[model samples]
Target: MISARERLLNYAILIVFSAAALFPMIGVVAQALQFPDLDAGTFRDAWREGHFGTYLRNSAIVTAVTVACASVLSIMAGYALGVLRLPGSEALFLLFLAGLTVPTEAVVIPLYFDLRTLGLDNTYAGVILPQVAQSVAFGTYWMRAYFRGVPRSLIDAARIDGASSWTTLWRVLVPMGRPAILTMVVLTSMWTWNEFLLPLVILNSDEGLRTAPLGLSFFQGSHQTDYALLTAGALIIAAPVVLLYVFLQRRFIAGMLSGAVKE
Candidate 1:
């Protein structure tokens, strides 16, 4: 048990750090509402002027498809590597890990040219595919750790009950690993949603296909002196991610804690 004084000190420290982190965000909101009456029309004006509807829709499509494809691929690859222990699985797992090491900047230019050659430039597929690959690399590593930590007894029981590998994975392990999977989904969604470089390069020719972050950059360029509109646009671009984390924070924390304990 901790002493009351120590607990109070810890709380004080946390409060200090939390305030430090929150002040800037609060300031941004205040700056965005700089009008005398705190008008809400700034956000509306930013939305219309920025053409954020199209940008947000494009971001949604890319993020959803990337997360969905990456999650499925990660689960399968992780299961094969973590649970099945397939031949040369370590080599294959290491190969996936290599993907995580290679920075996007290193390959993005070539990737753009490749996509162009394939006639996929300025298209949703071009944007979605690279992010899916990136997400799957991390997701595979994440899910593999989760699967590897699952109780061996559970696998034995499933086998004795005549569950095929696919059935066991989907019916037994997947349900049990919901927290871990959800954590991956949230993370991948955030990364894909925030990705600027990939979309900037891949969709360079298509203004209609610009993601929110890219749109915000161009919006910022045009509204260089308008801090109110700028901050409003920034908040609009960030709101979905913030709302997502707010709603899923509990499960995300649980999954993180569970992973740490298991590992």
Candidate 2:
């Protein structure tokens, strides 16, 4: 157990880091609120002029589709790798794990050409598909570890009850794995929403298809000197991710702690 002195020291460190992170955000918020007649009109003007409404919609669609597809694929792949007895499953799992090591920048240039060859460039499909692939890679790794850590007795009991693999996974393991799964979804959503490079390369021409981060970059370029509009636009783009983290904080923390304990 931690002593009172250790706890106090830990809190002190956290406070220091928390203030470091919040200081910039406080400045940005203050700038947003203080400029342009010292009111909230900056946000409205930034919203209208920056055309973030369309960008937000595109980002929402891409993120939703990518997360949903990646989660389903991850769960299935993880289940197969973690529990099922198949030939060369270990090698297959390692292949998925290898994807986690490959940096996005290394393949992004080639990916652009490949997508262009497939005539998917400048389209929502182009952006969403690549991000979905990236998300699935990490998601598979995450879910596989969680499923592999499940007790053998629990799985055996489910099988003894004459449950099929599908039923066992959905009815038994899935319910028990809610925290892990929710954590994975939240992480994937955050990654997908914040993704900029894939969208930037794939969506060169279609402004309507730009994700929030990409749109924010373009907005910044046009409003180079306008800090208020820039900060407000950033806040608008970042709000969804912040709200998501806030709402899922408990589940995310539980999942992370459980994973750490298991490790």
lDDT for model 1: 0.92
Q: What does candidate 1 score on TM?
A: 0.91
Alpha-carbon runs more than 4 Å astray in model 1: 1-24, 33-38, 261-263
Clashing residue pairs found in predicted model 1: none
lDDT tens string, model 1, 114-143? 999999999999999999999989999999
Kindly give the stretch of ten consecutive residues in candidate 1 with the minimal lDDT sum. 30-39
lDDT leader: 1
lDDT of each: 0.92, 0.89
lDDT of 2 at 108: 95
Question: How well is each residue in 1-263 modelled by candidate 2, as lDDT tens digits?
Answer: 99999999999998999899679768777776676653478779989999999999999999999999999999999899888857999899889888888998999999999999999999888988888888888888888888889988999999999999999999999999999999999999999999988888889998888889999999999999888778889899989998999999999999876554252
TM-score of each: 0.91, 0.91
Count of backbone clashes, every candidate in sequence: 0, 0
